[model samples]
Target chain A: MSRSSRTFRGTYFSCMSVQSVSRILAVAFCLVSACTPQQEPDQEPQVRILELQVPANFPEPEKVMAGYPLSEEGVELGRKLFYDTRLSGSNTISCASCHQQQLAFTDGVALNKGAAGTPLLRHSPGLANLAWMNGTFWDGGAKNLESQAFGPITAPDEMNQNLQELVSELTAVPDYVASFRLIFQDEIKPAYIARALAQFQRTLISANSRYDKYVRQEPGGKMSELELKGLTLVQQKCGSCHAGDLFTDNGYHNNGLDSDFSNHSYEGIFQGRYRITHHPADVGKFKTPTLRNVLVTAPYMHDGRFATLEEVLRHYSQGIRASPTVAAAVMQGAEGVAGIPLSVEEKQAIIAFLETLTDYEFIQNEKFSSPFN
Target chain B: MYRIRRSGFYVAMLAILFLAACKEEKEGPAATTSVTVSFQHVVGSEPLQLDEVIYTSPAGDSYAVSNFKYFVSNVKLISSAGEQIYVEPESYHLIAQDGKTSFELKEVPAGTYQRLELSLGIDEELNHRIDHLGDLDPSNEMVWDWDTGYKFLTLVGTYTGQTRSGGLVFHIGGDTNYRTLALELPQPLNPRQDGSSQVLLQANVNELFQGPNLIDFDVMNSSGHGSGPSLIAENYTSGFITVLEAK
Candidate 1:
């Protein structure tokens, strides 16, 4: 038989490559002699059930809180609901509206307007490895993920959704109702809504960065000479605040962003940790965010004042201003200077190192992407 | 062994017979009365007709309310003897200006009560755990958005552009600012052992401006962002509960 016309084990043949033709011939040759039919590989889902895959070298991640067990059905339901717009009052915006997957879950803007077109004061940061976070939001106001999901959904300026009516609305959709029933085996409720959302968010693990791979000593994970030098500098300087494998100390600090509070508009000056802690000392403190995808999640800081990593590095170098509650470390310089000192070359090296922290695998993970999209 | 088995069977048969006899005698679950509390909203002394450009704030701001919604939870009943009976799950309720009527208590104990109490908004400790707590669901229009807290009361409408410009929006929420205010009113009730009763809660919209915290709509037209809402919200706590019409 012709190579193109040949078939073996119910598989069609096309001799596009010599390797493929040889494999086909070998299979045919085997069949001609004496053989049993080969079986086709089992069909898998487009997006498989993802578990929190911690790297071998990485420390044990915080456990998913009790009562909020990560179930396959729940994660699947949460994945669907994360993109569903019904959570918004206008039904036009969903959690995924601001948290798109391409830009490391951020919408790629300094600040996106809420559902009511009210310009948000703070920029929406990218979400990854959130199960390890002790608190939620820039202010750390939300106690847990359950409380965090409700913020944007019911925020007047954001989705402005009425969570009380959300269950009924979701139940009206036959597919959603069926899916919810399959997981909960009971009526849809707001608690379940929060649970499903939390479940899905827990699956957003991003531990495959080049830096992570480098730590694992895997191929393509080797750091360049500049990157290695920058890593040494980061360990000496930035490592105090942005520490550990997650690249976050999980503590609040005022990074000497502003000097005078009067410069900000009324209620516009975010009081970060003070709002949650209510301590006078925490006047301008903000929770240290994870720099897992620092390359993609630009327009940095709580209010997104810095637009580029260069600006961020510059802020660390010499841009920090005087503030009463500014961290002692940030204010430490040759003569108790406001900001840290950095040369032009050092800044480039640091930027190069920060770029290695990018994890293309996590950002492009199909399971984390909106099923609806 | 046979004798013991015979006696055990007799005991089981007697137990079943006794249970069946009790089931036949009793009508259903325990005979308790339901007390329906109807909310009657008013502007000054007249029935409140929403969207009517008639009501004027004490601050001389001519305003017409398009939306007036507030949460009421943890309703309690106190008898003449000071015996308290609290509604389970806190009896969270939403009383809005439009299309909202009486909230019924399906399992209220029958008694002659002289005092009735219900909180204006959700309790502070219970507020943070707002997931699917029935009526306190964020999906309910009564929510103030999630970041800050639940809005105890929302009075949204258009007012004269003297104090502030544009549409008047007052979303009163937060824990330390203006928490739940428990309103205790004199309520004389005589409920039957297996019957229902009614309690009409009249909320005078005018009192919202007249109370100790005199609200000037023009100056405080909108306050969902800062400590401004608490000013008007404080006044509202006392002003909202006008009367308790028990029937």
Candidate 2:
């Protein structure tokens, strides 16, 4: 193929010629032939509809395919954009820099540094089943996935990329220009970039864990007695917050991580949901994360303070600090002692059950892997 | 799925049917005109000279405005016969001090309009998404990425207060802070078919700090991401903008 035909530049020149010819023909046709009043601006581009299926074992997505419907081409374009480091200011970091497919999307670190080498205030959370979530981030500030992508991509501490500059850079690449025009039917813009990313992130579904198989009674679904006991204990203790089959109620709760929220630094990063809502009762409250692939997505909590599941369980059992907004369920412990009292063996059993929650299939899935690789 | 257009014969027939259906309910003259609303920014009686002129606020604070940008949307013109003509498709506009000062309400029914109603900010439905293009584009820096909303008004400058003096930033946004301004035109606007009429609107910058809540720059110099936006929104009701003339 000629280089001209390979790029959208060729299409642009052809379109201009087509418009000139149509204008001349329009006048001539008006004199000779009857012309239709319906004016077709341009030929409609082809797009294939992709229906997103919810797993039978999982609940219906809280926001199931509403705005910006999914398309096969759009999702493929999104996957490429998700791994493209061109999104960052220095062209050194992408969304995949922190959200790796192997680690179930999280960066397996307490606090991942940004493209600028500054330590981010919060830990990178795993991205799976995000379609079921109403809000994103620790504070639930961003309303949806499309809006959430902007926070990291534009934040000076994160990607540090100027959105207009990013658009210009993307426009330079013919492949991106063609794909974006085909998918969005408009020139490359930040809103379309975010929509494409959200579409790809929504496809990061991780529901094939052993626990999920056990619940669905699928093959290889057997669990050890200790794991079953741990599952029961989790249902009794941690189920209120990390509630249903998705392993999260998707609600904000003050899990008694800190007593003092005086840290107004970075626009009240330590204050949690209160920073967004400004409600006094929401101080130190963070969104409940799904426990799927918890074994690999280590360094738990919003700040990633706990390194192991054992430490997380210990925090719930003994290390829960007293706060004004401590969850009512956690405060329902025996005789004013906050948190669910778990013995050493119970903690071990819970860890084993959490191991069952890890979906190796999702981590090893080549579909969600980088397009560049 | 992409829509494949029907043959020319079928399209012509469909167009005829559609126009016939639309004509049954419509009683006005079929001709349409455009209305141009122009905004003139000023500090009291003086024309706003961005980054050059220093103006005093109601709180007696001297401030030099470096930037002033705001969104005006959902424009409606109330006709003398009580008919309302709403500007559609692209009603949202970002009026900046340095950028375009006016926008045309296209395809308006040629008639006499006595009042103009327009929202000062984006509606709750469109404001939260931040995915819209043109005017509502997130690249304009009017959007709050972390909070997932648009800043209705942004007035950035330097101020010299009595006790404290530094940068002055009054960024007002949020659903609660979205205010609508209804202006009674000085005279009836008669936009004839195939022609246009201009509505001269004046935006007084000093009114931002001269309302029911007199904003002292020393006390709240840089605020709007929190509870401060609603207080600044109250300033809209106190003659921040007035329809100077309708010609």
Candidate 3:
């Protein structure tokens, strides 16, 4: 009833004249109906809609905020949960433990330690522009953020949390109980916990980088000659996988990381996307990570084998091992050569261009920083 | 006077229509009843007692089932006229061996049902989404956190065979492994308005090893992915569940 009444008021305000009988009726109706601020007519009535501003240069993602819309309360709850160590079994490690804000949400380590001090198998990928990612993780195993949160939280070496116990822990906290009730209007379940964390992560949009500015033709977008050359080289060489303005095609590929795929340790960690798909062609294939903040997010690759951009470039130019499942685009060199031919100058230029992707505003933004601090 | 009479006639007609609508609401033929589907798990002919009973498979592997859990969803009651009456809102059920084994399918129309159509796993549309409550809840440990899908069926136990003597984890899942089972009721199930109908089903654990695909614990000891899960899933299509009775 309140929703329909609001719609009627909106229509009346847009077209009705002050002297019109309909306007008089609307005014009288509003006076009786308590014309206060109302939420969007969603199923969850109390949810205060938080609009995510897609940059002018960036294409709007098809399903940016479906199923779980970004609500002001939900984001705030998620931000708290993201930083809260209570989600972990030991109450020591949180999502923020590995995904820090300063390094574009990546811990500055090749292999970050888990809650139990065990080194994680894969390098912690930076979290930015995740709203557009069709899948999560290096192998794209987890379909989305909601499902992705369960991985690290329950992982024995990671947060090592028993989800049921985590629910009880959060439920014990009066503040969490109140917030969960206010936002979800249901009991504090793992599903709602995931939805909240997902809402916060989806808001981690990083389109304010210098490269983004240059594309948008905005101020402070001036690029040097080398950087422009690097951009062209990247467009030519890396655009097949790291395609589009989002800096990722959001597809899996084998960039010839390894030649063999027989190893099945750690549940086929070395097998790459083949672990998820069980397809022979998918062996050594991994989801193409975004090059945004590539300067800060090191060491590179799925296993974090490369510590610098130079090593990564060298891998593409020469270090690419000949594998059956390797991407066809990676084999762009002369007959015997395995990878793209890139001179030292071109690699340096590409590195310089990639540095421009580091968004200072996003890194220093207090909104994304730890609330406890 | 004629205009006032016309308005009065219209008001009278509206009142009569409202009365008719109310009468229809009170005495409508559309009545709903609930059906209680109960599961009785077994190992061949004997009752499945967790952690104690060691049952030998067709492949001659002595295995004691420590835990057995599976999802039963998309329940549909088929009429003799070939019409399907699907259970709505919440049809997905996670029936665990040690936990809840029975659930009620509410709002079933009064009809003579001949067979029951059920799926062994969550549908593709619902499987990917982890934001579900109740039995489909990810916290139940019936979900694969890394792979982001429900483990349609998990039979965890220890097995001793000629080739191997270790844990048997048949954590079957994946969208491709979702199997549908159609079973004929013992008799016509005509649920009354009083909601007193029960569909009793017996799940023979031996069927998981035997059926179209005979699974040996020696080779296919554990599987979360690959061809092993599909082989185990195929076994359920035939002799896994049977309608014991319908009352």
For model 3, the stretches where C-alpha displacement exceeds 4 angstroms are A1-45, A64-66, B1-30, B84-86
What is the lDDT of every predicted structure here? Answer: 0.73, 0.84, 0.85
Native contacts kept, each candidate: 0.31, 0.51, 0.56
Candidate 3 structure quality by residue, lDDT tens digits, A1-373: 3210101112213333556857666645654444344656674548688888887877776485334668898998999999999989999989998999999999989898897687889999899988888789999899888899999999998999999999999999999998888777777999889989998998898999999989999999988999999999999999999898888898999898889889999888889989998888899999899999989889898888999999999999998888888898899987746899999999999999998889998888888888889
Per-model TM-score on C-alpha atoms = 0.75, 0.89, 0.88
How big is the positional error of residue A205 in model 3, measured in Å on the Cα after superposition?
Answer: 1.0
Clashing pairs in 3: none
Q: Write the per-residue lDDT of candidate 1 for residues A75-144, one digit (tens) a residue.
A: 9889999999898887899898889887788887888998878779888978988878867787677766
lDDT ranking, best first: 3, 2, 1
DockQ of each: 0.12, 0.29, 0.29
- Backbone clashes, each candidate: 11, 0, 0
Expressed as tens digits, the lDDT of each residue in A116-221 for candidate 2 is 7878989999999988999999999999888888899999999999999999999999999999878877779888898899889888889899998999999999
Which 10-residue window in model 2 chain B sums to the lowest lDDT?
Answer: B21-30
Q: If ranked by DockQ, best first, what sequence of candidates would result?
A: 3, 2, 1
Question: lDDT tens string, model 1, B1-247?
Answer: 9999999999897566445434522354545567778888887767777787567676666777888888776666667777545343346677887755668776565667766667766666656545544566556655532353577888887777454645777777767554444444555777654555777788877777766777776566677455676676677777677546676
Q: What C-alpha RMSD does candidate 3 show over the true interface residues after superposing them?
A: 11.3
